[model samples]
Target: MYGSQPARTGRTTLLAVLLAPALALAGALVLLAAPAHAANAPRTSVNPVIFVHGQEGSAQQWQSQAKRFSSNGYRDDQLYVHEYDTSVATDDHAIAGLEALVDTVRARTGAAQVDILAHSRGTRVAHAYLAVPERAAEVAKYVNLDGRTAAAPPGGVPTLAIWSSLQPNGSIGGAVNVHEPQAGHTESATSAESFGHIYAFLRGRAPLTTRVLPELPTSVEIAGRALYFPQNTGLAGRLEVWRLDPATGARAGLLPQHVVRVGADGAFGPLAVNGRGHYELALVRSGERTNHFYFEPFERSDRFVRLLVSPPGGVADSIDACPGHTALTVVRAREWRADTEGDDRLRIGGSDVLNAAVSPRLRQILGLFVFDKGCDAVSHLDAALPPFDRIPFLTATDLHLPADAQARGTIPVTQTMRGTGGIEETIAVPNWPSDRHTVSLLFKDYADIPSGG
Candidate 1:
């Protein structure tokens, strides 16, 4: 989706034009001596890699690639992402930001030079910085992903240009150009083929493994998506991989064995598991360790497991009824408000509940839901909320009840004005029947009472 205008090039002379500069640049630069290590030691460490995103892209665009780099022993701090506003920002502005970022990364990692990987419009920013001899001197290598520039070496740095059939192939003089006929623009950023080329170009050898895997010996491997909901197309979060004690089935410790970012596409891992035992994988929100989906590996035997952020009971099964009997469906609703007062109610609930008073300066909402024993808690729902709804209101729907079931839903309303505290009351829907189709569990005095409940 972030592809740019294609550059025209001659197909017959593409190979010669592309490799010329890279070969010359390789000869011009003096090679550093390798560190002394055992023959079986891991590959020699390379310079830190700075990723530049394309137009309308954010640092999150490189999540999968970053994880891949991490799997190859690059520490989190050694990898950097240069995020900039591509829409209104000029190439000079981006170049300046990149220059500062590269200096910071070099200082932090103590690397003499850094490698760069840019995609689509990001190629413009990277090329601009490299065109300057002073700035380009800090770059060890440049990997262009599905982006085009003139058939010349970028700042005389060794370059590898990867092109997808979705865009016309282009070349850089003295650089290595690879064309993958099946890969799309975005796929060029996330695919294994792309990583293979990038790893070889930067490290001077093929990757031992193209996919992310655990360092320890493993009998089985788990791979799949970690989604917010079963129906959700994608999710963005951190997956904390923890080891489990086979005997007690308890988590080993607070520290994660390996922590990887789950991409917006929801794909997480081909994570290695040591043996047949229970393991816990949590989808913790970025920066907050406590707020997460903590659960055991759901699919033990299958190679691919889809870990969904669902309530205890399964939703689909709860809605499934006898052949002739119909299940009851309800619309779950809540009230949300945020303003500059001492009173702010934030309610977040599912199988767990979190109710707290937020700062008066921040706007917030309290979303609460209740379900019968056989019914699962609401996880996936439509976005539509009742009137005067703010931008970030929470809505949970598609909750169903079995025949002859009764449950109670509660909404605790509290408000504070000035220094004194306001009224606090619990609004409850007691003995709610499964025969009823719609249940409006709203905050007191906020929603209109429905007729014929």
Candidate 2:
């Protein structure tokens, strides 16, 4: 039942043949007259959607789309990202993988069919699978994101073809072909507009809400990206939102009000916020807290807000001075060296220095000095040589430095009895900067300590 052409080459030629003036016009006319459906209509239960990524792509590619789906009421279990070694595997092998994935999803969800969405080279794998008689019946629908196929109505299932390039010739008989000429190939897979169309096609209705929410009624929406400094590239991690007490300006509770995973592109929520108040959004890696951003929701004039996670010492007054700084500002923990066996003491000209250190790369050292006496305060001291007496009893500095500065350097951490320990890091800096020219660094604790050094 599969098409006769060698998997890759024929689709392009077929597209050319199909794009005759008359057929193109017919397809356009059909697409224009398509009826619009109400998003709030009693929705039908949809089968799981299986996403296949392009060559050199990973399952992470689907993160934003998956969260978008989750925002629209689809559970995590209802979405499947089928990852494969596209470079090493043949089309047949990839199709076999897809087949197995589909079967597993079907059995787990107990749905009669699943919808398939494939991008770029992944279209070949989907087409190969759909061309098989047995597999054809298992898909309720298919979405072709910037991919070409010779046959109209690929797999004979209802199809929606979202194109980023020139309109394809000859319609896939009875399929909907959408032309998003402005979107890039990757954009077609991640854009909100594309998600709207996919949502409609898969659910047979429009989306009630295209953005993510905090599981509560919301009056405003917050959306933005996360990245690391110097390189200013997107970050993939978890975001925890906590509500604050307006009167005391303290966290209301230990549990987060909402949490969502940021995608590989660093794109995060259209997170729903209930009303104007104080909130703390924490960016964490794995489960370790890395950075905490505090803000008042009402202070924002617009529904959308932008947050830049600056590098340790590069949080200059303006973006120009910092250049490409996106590291998490601070790494904090309670009593980082409390019960350790050795005395880590820092002696600056005979007297014991308890708090802070000087990094040659930074102009200043910023940290929270936590004392054994049950009080904490933020201290901003010179990076070159912090005075012995000026240092606090216990301190945790949120160090910042220039984007191009050395990431691996020696910083001293000490207590009167504990002596001195050097905290060194071979920082894993991000490779690219976000549109905002910001990126973040994961905080590393002490590497080695030479007591009385």
TM per candidate: 0.43, 0.43
Q: Residue by residue across 1-453, what tens digits does model 2's lDDT show?
A: 011101111000000113458867765311111111222233346787888877544443465566556556564446666655543557776787788888877776678899999987888788888888789899999998877655577778889988863343423556787877644455567666788899998888886544422222233445555544322345677888778664433467879888989877566665656545556666777542355554433211121122334344532212222333322222211122222345233332122333334321011121232111111122233322223124321132223322334222222222232222343222222212122222322121122222110
Global CA lDDT of candidate 1, please?
0.49
lDDT of 1 by residue, 342-361 (tens): 43333322211222221112
What's the distance in Å from true for residue 177, model 2? 0.4
Candidate 1 collision pairs: 18-174, 18-175, 19-174, 20-174, 21-174, 22-174, 338-363, 347-366, 347-367
Root-mean-square deviation of each candidate, in angstroms? 20.9, 21.2
Off-target runs (Cα >4 Å) in candidate 2 are: 1-44, 166-171, 214-453
- How many clashes in each structure? 9, 38
